[model samples]
Target chain A: MRVVVPVSGSDPKTRLASVLTPDERRDFTDAMLADVLDALTGAGLEPAVVSTAPVDCDAPVTVDERGLDALVNDLLASTVDEAGGALAIVMADLPLATPESVDRLVSTDGDVVLAPGLGGGTNAFVCRHPDFRVDYHGASIRDHRRIARDAGVDLSEVDSRRLATDIDEPSDLAEVLLHGDGAAADWLADAGFEVALTDGRVAAVRK
Target chain B: MRVVVPVSGSDPKTRLASVLTPDERRDFTDAMLADVLDALTGAGLEPAVVSTAPVDCDAPVTVDERGLDALVNDLLASTVDEAGGALAIVMADLPLATPESVDRLVSTDGDVVLAPGLGGGTNAFVCRHPDFRVDYHGASIRDHRRIARDAGVDLSEVDSRRLATDIDEPSDLAEVLLHGDGAAADWLADAGFEVALTDGRVAAVRK
Candidate 1:
């Protein structure tokens, strides 16, 4: 099975002050995707970064050139078009996103799986069939499950720290900061994120 | 045992936005302090809010016109003077503060107890003796323990939610928001804090 992470540069909740510059955003996103690729490769599955913009990586990096939705559909379609296999569409914002999480999602066949966010939104999605529409936005967990049920695809839900953690908000950043060093951990740490956190820049934004 | 909670106007993190009116700051402080009170109350201790300025509370309130350290010492002296009993000095900030936690700390009354926060800071101190000079600032947990040990006061470490959480930033707000509605919750609900939180205003403060 192949895993494709669709990263959005947008973080609805950004805690670290300018933690990512435009250049850094691309680099950060690429590094996160690389971590995912490394995880997938470690698990014996093909992994790729599918973004609207191209990213340099050891693994294949495909630029959708299209929007996020189009990029998602394109990635899933390419799984069948290229390898004739299923794909898992994951959000790139998750700092804790790990290969183990992706493997678990893509391991099952003929089924759709989802990992819901803390606020009841779908953070990760997996589908066995490419025909499953990628309508994962705004509390899409329920919608994806319904779609899976209607399509008669086997359904499952996973509660995972990796999947649950998508760094989008200030609080999310706190979790990322609190997360003992990992793939995305260094990115924040190297940028003096901890200083801003301890010094209260993050708290100021929160207030 | 008598408990002393010192409320201060000086913020170490400088996270509060200048856009907020004086009323907003007061409300914010009140909401934050209320969370601490709720936790202490939940722990079955009679929580007293000792403020450098007059603080509004449903619980007993004490105004400390002198200074934070002096007020704290006075409160501690009230319980631990030559004739005094056990005293716990709590700081007003932790939103995840729970009463069950304080109970656990006080349960070991014979020992000098210290609850540490992020980076070796003291959140609350329970001392059996009044002669011990309490330093409730800057690595105070380590300082207090050392002081207690030097004074021959049995030292104990109580790792509780009360000791771990102190809302100084936006990240800390998540716990207060996520936890079941408390006094802070009510104040937020009344002041329409949900508008900012739900509308992603809270998310905007991120780095």
Candidate 2:
């Protein structure tokens, strides 16, 4: 399977602006990308890092300035045609992703296997059958279901908390600090980000 | 309007098990209940704390010893019938709720005004129409919408971050710490619950 880990190199994790500086966001994004790449590699799959701009990471980087939905759709079409097998796309914000989780995605038997995000977004997906295009619109998970049904392709859904918990909003940073010990976690630790009692409530802050 | 603040007194916030002890949970629940009551009272509404077990808070406690859906449904049914006006049910976990937000719920013109939680739950709601009822099952917000449509009553959705922010999981403690200066935030602060970096990731922990 040809796996693509998409990262936002230009400006990433904008939702975390409340808790992270712009540079911190980029660094955190790279750290999460590293974690995803490590998991994909540990699963015995060679993955490529696709980003909007050039990102400094260990993996082979492919910079494509296209919008998320269009870029991934194009990548899937070309890769599946050439490889004639499974092609997977994973979001880079999944700091809690593990080798076993990646293995689950590839091992699931279906034309399309999806790991749905908490807000009904498709976090990671494997497209095995030909003619199954991708769409990341509003409520894309629900849209994916309809697209799969119309295409008459089997769709397998993977319900994993680690995969579902993508680090998007500032509130999500708590999950990584609590449950993860990955490169992203290390980056966050180095950056002095922690869950702290700020003015009497629970919050993630740099302390 | 009779405002009912529903709380799970027996085992509240099971999702926060990783961070809070049982006693801490009880205390935090009471603190949040106090915040909700303060908001309701500030809005000139007589609020009652409805719980499965007896709870000590700022409001009058009404122990029903029933499941959440059953108790809230019963309260809404009886209150709507008796008052011949609007009746509201607000979750006890909304420490960030303000008098302004509660007033928005009561003042909204609709048969049923729902304040949807981040997770598909109804955090706060106003039932004005005679036939309008509530269902707090799994994904109950969507169920309530269907119920309203079936009953042919207009449904108003109040989208407020304060109303949407309900402290459920350990990660949720961050919101209260970040934006809340309420009793719940004070309780969390006193309990030593803070967002901190533990071993690399961000987590809400007692130091």
Candidate 3:
């Protein structure tokens, strides 16, 4: 199985602009990408990064400047045409993703395995069927399910908090601080980010 | 490790009453329970059923007439005081749960491993820490997270569609028909329940 981690090397985590400067976002994104790569490697799978621009990582980086939907669709098409093996796509922002969780996502039997994000996005997925493609639009998880159904493929969903969480908003950082133990968590801690409870909700705040 | 599946044999799946009669609901619930037990046993875990009434199954059934929270808390306390081993609680309605998914739930290392349901419920959980208890109220997953945090235990959440999906509503049966290959799915199929698209949503309707 070939695993791919999609990342935006430039201007990543724009939703976190309120809490992070452009440089900090870029650094944090790299940290998260490193954590995801480590998790995939720990799971005994070699992962390559599909970034929008050049990234400094041990994994082989393929800079695809296209939009997410197009990039993923092209990857799916090429995987079908060339390798004809299973392809697993994991978002780079899921710092909480552990090796065990990644194993669960890949080990399950299905033509297409989807890891739906908390906010109705497709955070990660394993595509084993040639017909299955991705559409990363509004509620992409729902769209993926529909697409799988339309393609007449068996779909399995990996319900994992680790995979479901993508660090886009500032509030999402709290989850990384709380449940994460990888490079991203270390970066946040080094940057003086801590978990705080504001209005009965958890948030990551710099102290 | 001890595995316990709590079931309300008296009045189960009341929310599904609109579609099923009392006897049908009882039978359906039993089928789901059977599937859950099969999954647990398949995962090499001996699971006992803690039910409000007698249930005809291969596993040992402990008739506990207490509420869900009380029964689970009491079980947690006993497991701490006597067994000194981990306790895994899997709800009866998760027909989609396969042995692989169950293995992922129990195999993960954490003091408290939570599998949050689709509708803010804690469907299945493995509790290794003595201080961890369950509260099956509104948004119990959130409460469990908070409780684990307060108890200073290492918390791990398993995001699995198989574990997260509990059949409580009529619409939920579509998932069983689609993804489940267990006794519960067979039961629903035998009952002539088929997946129907209603209002752009998948639903289980009788032919």
Candidate 4:
């Protein structure tokens, strides 16, 4: 199966802007991209980076400046059209993603296999059926399921906590710092991020 | 509207056993119960505690040894049977629930109003329609919606992140430690719990 890792190298991770500067965001995004690439490679599947701009990673990179839906949908359609095989699109911010989880998603038997992120987003997906397309709109997990059902394709969901946990809001950094020892975790540790109890709750912040 | 806060004073929060002792669990449960009581009381409605054991709180306490679903369902059936008025059932672990969120739930016009928990559980609900009952089984939120639809009732959902965040798992303690300032949060803080970056994710622990 061909894997596509969509990374917004240009001004990525704006949600974490409150906690990290623009340079820090770029560094964090690169760390997450490296972690994702390592996981994909460890699974023995060749991954190609689909980015908005050029990114330095140890993978074959493809720069497509189109919108998320258009870029992924076009890639899915053409990948299946030319080779007539399976394709998977994985998000680049899953710092906790593991090789085993990626392998589970790829090996799952379904016309459309989806890995749902928290709050109704698609973290990763494996498309085998010809009519299966990608949609990253609001609540796109539900939207994609409906789309597959309407298209008469079998849909399967990967129940993985590692794949579900993506680095988004600052609070999500807690997951990486606590459960991850990957490139992202190493970067966060070096950046002086620590989990502290702020105002009676757990927050990731630096002194 | 009469509000019923269901609590298992017998052995509450067994899921937190890994992080808290039995006695600590009881204390934490009481603190969360108290926080929920304050939220209910601030909503201008006198609430009652439907508990398995005697609990000290500002509201009236009723000792009901019945099972969770049976007790809440009976309360819903009898409340509508006796007064033909609305009854709301709020969970005892919603330490972050505010007065405005509770008020939003009660004031919402619906035959059945449901507050969905992060998981597939019903956290809080208002039963005004005669046929509306309670179900706390697996995936009860989805089940309740289907029940309300089958009964020809207008079902409204309360979309409050505060109300949805309940203290169940140890990881959930991160939420309380991060966003809560109630008795439960204070209890957790005074107990020396802090959010720590462990194993690449955020977790609550004390050294």
**Stretches of model 4 off by over 4 angstroms after superposition:** A198-201, B1-207
- Give the candidate order by descending lDDT: 3, 4, 2, 1
- Which scores higher on TM-score, 1 or 3? 3
Q: Which of the predicted structures, 1 or 2, would earn the higher lDDT when compared with the native?
A: 2
lDDT of 1 by residue, B105-176 (tens): 778555578776643457777878756777655445556767887888777765343355566644445445
Q: Estimate each model's TM-score.
A: 0.48, 0.53, 0.63, 0.55
Model 1's CAPRI class is incorrect
Among all windows of 10 consecutive residues in model 1 chain B, the one with the lowest summed lDDT is B198-207
Higher-ranked by DockQ: 1 or 3: 3
Residue A97, candidate 1: how far off, in angstroms?
Answer: 22
Name every residue pair that clashes in candidate 3: A159-B159, A159-B160, A159-B161, A160-B159
lDDT score for candidate 4 against the true structure = 0.82
* Tens digits of lDDT, candidate 1, A70-183: 677776677754566667766666655555655665664446677655443567777666456666554455567777788776777654545665565444555555532466
CAPRI band for model 2: incorrect
lDDT by residue for model 3 (B1-207), tens: 889999998978998999999999999999999999999999999999999999988799999899999999988988964678789999998998889889989998999999977545788999988898888776577789999999999998776767877888776787787667888989989999876644333467798
Ranking by DockQ: 3, 1, 4, 2
